[model samples]
Target: MKNKNVINYFKQVHADKVEYNKQMARLKELPSDYQVVYKEVQKFLWEFTAGDGMDMLPPMLELLDFFEEGAANNIPVLQLVGEDVGSFAENTLHEMQAKTRINELKRKMNERIAKKISKE
Candidate 1:
């Protein structure tokens, strides 16, 4: 079952690769004016891929989380690495906030219990 999921994911990824190659070839055949647009698009993609420090941290953490979860769940290949590009940092921040909230709740509950025991 997991193998089938992996195979299907790769199939879709491969199809996207084929489509990207076709687009590049079409771009290559375009006139000089349009070639400049393609060049700018390539530049933007490069910048997006090679993001800076804080940008790098979120994806790294996300991969770790996905791996830990997958390992515990007996799943192969999380397939989360390249699936997110635009919202990587945003999602990680949200996860971090949720973790902090969980910790805060635990701390408050512990404090309340301690106060109740002291008054008894």
Candidate 2:
């Protein structure tokens, strides 16, 4: 996440604090692998967040719920993300990135660069 957005996010937490706390408690109850993947993915994805990452919240919460469901069902964590687990997180970030304003800007930037390079 952008540093400015991260700071803004923390500042806005008073409203979401209860829900966030509940998620954290659910996190604590997760299996170790789920916990590890969740933290790593969160850090990776945070770097891609735009506008306080408000748009990213729903999917992040859904991820925690997915992990919790898997754990409750006795499903192996790797089964959820697959082998080469880090890639799972990376792929997840890429998916989430698609919905952010930054990604749209990035698309436009690449298009501009391509056009300029092509002398069109």
lDDT of each: 0.48, 0.79
Q: How many residue-pair clashes does candidate 2 contain? A: 2
* lDDT per residue (tens digit) for residues 73-94 in model 1: 6543324322443354344444
- Write model 2 residue lDDT over 3-48, tens digit each, in one string: 9998886777765676777777889899888899888877777777
lDDT of 1 at 17: 64
Give the CA lDDT, 0 to 100, for residue 31 in model 2: 83
Q: Pick the candidate with the highest TM-score.
A: 2
lDDT for position 67 in model 1: 44
Best by lDDT: 2
RMSD of 1: 18.0
> What shift in Å separates residue 58 of candidate 2 from its native position after superposition?
0.6
- Identify the runs in model 1 with alpha carbons over 4 angstroms from their true place: 49-120
